[model samples]
Target: MDLTTYAILLAGALAGGFVSGLSGFGTAVMALGIWLYILPPAIAVPLVLICSVSSQISTLPSMWKVLDFKLAGPFVAGGLVGMPIGALLVARADPQNFKLSVGVMLLVFPTALYFIRKPMAFRFGGRPADAAIGFAGGILGGLAGLSGPLPTLWASIRGWTKDQRRGVFQIFNGSVLGAALILQIASGFVKWDVFWLAMLALPGTLIGARLGMRTYHALNDRNFYDVVLALLFLSGIGLVWSSIAPR
Candidate 1:
């Protein structure tokens, strides 16, 4: 790759890594825009899975104390069920309208999140609601590399503690994205060149994640929630920009 493409690759990795590290998800929103400019969707999409999973792995130790498999189980099960369906629908969907609609929600929802005087914990719907949300996230992830928002939004609404929210989405995103990566590999998406690109991404991903974790640890639960909402807002902007930009 040329120096410019190489630069863009690492920049995307680092940016996405930082967000994923801090928020437990969002690699696609942060990285795919720039990555798409340099690499085809075939390469860019799988590379996102690789770097995102890598970033999640590097930050796992911090999350272990808060992570609970029982809490994340239903979501994962729902995601697995939805994953293949997403793969089937990707080609048939109207990409622009779909993204624009999601982008608008991303923009609108975060504004509501910002207005909450305190973390408003809702108690209704529980596990079944979570599974349905996870199913939606899985479809979005598999379709557009956009999975974290729904779960993250739900967690916040559940009035979870910061770490609780973090742990659920981290485990949820990692499991779903990891499974997606495996599907990609089995489908022959990981060619030697893509592997090489991922290798180059490793250092930047780790560094960005490390830095993000440091910031993560520095914040109180409330500050972290605000940061996540801010990131979501920016992600909305990115989505809107990409949907309208030249492919």
Candidate 2:
């Protein structure tokens, strides 16, 4: 990639990493938005995965204490089962239609969260429900390179403490991202070019994540949610617009 492309990718990584560090989600949305404009979706997805996983690792040390392994475990298991299917769908499916579907889903998320005030707990009714959510998350993860929002929403409804929510989300994302990278490699979606780009973005990712963590500590819960909601809404609109506009 040229200097301009590299610059763009680095900027996106910084922005996405910061968001992920603060909110435990939004890295993919932030990075993918710019990356897709520069690279094919297939390559963009994997590249974003690489950066995201790296950021998660950086934040893992601090988040370990609050990590909800029990809740994360089942969701990850389901993601593993679902990702391969999503990969296949992405490979064969029409890009436009898939974008439209993803856009609709993105739009629906904030709306549902807005209206649904009843908070639920994270404890699954059973293994089946846990597995089901994982499967769904994995499928979406593989296809759109975004699977955290669904599980994050689920966790939020459960009234998880902020730290617990962050820990659960980071673990879930890290696992799915690892699996998705492997599948993408096997499927030939991951290329040397993309790998290089991800490597180039690593420094920025680390810096951004640390900065975000600092910022997160400074913000109150209400302020944090306000920021996250605004970002999510804006990112959703961007995705929807990119889906409809002529390529």
Q: Which candidate is the best by lDDT?
A: 1
TM-scores, one per candidate: 0.93, 0.88
What would the per-residue lDDT of candidate 1 be over residues 65-139, giving only the tens digit for each residue?
989889888888888777767656655767667767877888999889899867588978889988998999898
Per-residue error (Å), model 1, residue 50: 0.6
Candidate-wise lDDT, in order: 0.83, 0.76
TM-score of 2: 0.88
List ranges where model 1 is wrong by over 4 Å. 91-95
* Candidate 2 residue-wise lDDT, 124-179, digit = tens: 56657766877888887888678776776566566666776677678888888778
Query: Which one wins on TM-score?
Result: 1
Candidate 2: Cα lDDT at 137: 80
